[model samples]
Target: MATFPLEPVHDTFRAIATTVVPEAVALDRAGWERLEEIIAEALASRPERIHRQLRLFVRIVDWRARWRHRERFVDLDPLQRTRELERIERSRWLLLRRGLWGLRTLIFMGYYAQPAIQREIGYRARPEGWDAVRGAGR
Candidate 1:
């Protein structure tokens, strides 16, 4: 029931999320499964063009990993995977780096903003105080 074309892409994204967020290690099996589901849901809701672009980007990363290390990105050990991604993060091609950056940002934001995570981190939502700073004339 994945909105994406290939389930492997979801696996790759899960691997990437795990690599980027060490906190993910603390998640139980069900938590990890739910996290992957959350990421897939996020990708499914993007515009068509963006969805395709992100998919293509994952394919490219997979290819790059195999070409460089004779293994898929998800197959690489944690250290190797981190090193490879770091290389991509420093790419001269702005698009490649930016795409990964955007994906990483989305993954981290989604994971950390979960209500359970918020409570675990003691992140209490506060009422907006902007009214206090409104113009006196208003």
Candidate 2:
């Protein structure tokens, strides 16, 4: 069976459009219109592709958030509190800490990385072709 990240991509693109369009509208009506046109065209042509891109973008943002939080924990010197501990005790603490870090990294990478990888696979599997036009601006 084949699976796609269409849902994730759709959500991510919607998030980005929601966040960015407001700012664009504040620029000027013409600018807003132009942005709207671009968005409309993208949505009309390859909605699924845009959605996939958005999902990847969201995953990247989420990973960055996690990394920032992890940095805060590291800055707190979480390992320093265990000084003067026995070898076995220190080993156990280290194992647990390493396990947590590994798990976090895996999750972050898995969520963000798989979409792009899958997208490439999908693209190669089913390449997009040019659309046929029935009339000239009819």
Candidate 3:
């Protein structure tokens, strides 16, 4: 059985990811599964420092949820989760704010890297004029 990198915080991270990038919440089941695989792959490629930071971020989010609303981040209702995340995004502590930004960045990176999203955004691996430019030099 393969274990996920963020197993302990998977649900919390998924909620945060979908909340931060609302478009991701629109993904179908297959798309969501693909997103999970992409995130797991990215996490496996990173250094331990990044892995630790992500885990710590989940803990902080959970702690904040309990402190503010008496529930775990993953257990909160959608509105409450959104409110809590927004609060953290606006937190006075720079570290917490930055951490949330980092998490958002990772989520966005993985979400947008998918082929479907890439095409939707008109991102092509090779532009139409690339061959013309390359052949011109050749």
Best candidate according to TM-score: 1
Sorting all predicted structures by lDDT, with the top scorer first, yields 3, 1, 2
Q: Give the TM-score of candidate 1.
A: 0.77
lDDT per residue as tens, model 3, 6-107: 668888888888788778878897887777677778777678788888889888998989898888887888889889988988989999999989888878
Report the lDDT tens digits of candidate 1 across residue range 13-43: 7778878897876888777655656666777
List runs of model 3 lying over 4 Å from the truth. 1-3, 121-138
Looking at candidate 3, the ten consecutive residues that score lowest on lDDT are 1-10
Summarize candidate 2's per-residue lDDT along 1-138 as a digit string, tens digits: 123333344333333333322222133445333433444443455557644554454455334334645432112222321121112234556643443343233233333233343474463332333332323236
Q: Tell me the TM-score of model 3.
A: 0.76
Q: How accurate is candidate 3 locally (lDDT)?
A: 0.81
- lDDT values for all models: 0.77, 0.36, 0.81
TM per prediction:
0.77, 0.25, 0.76
Better of 1 and 2 by TM-score: 1
Clashing pairs in 3: none
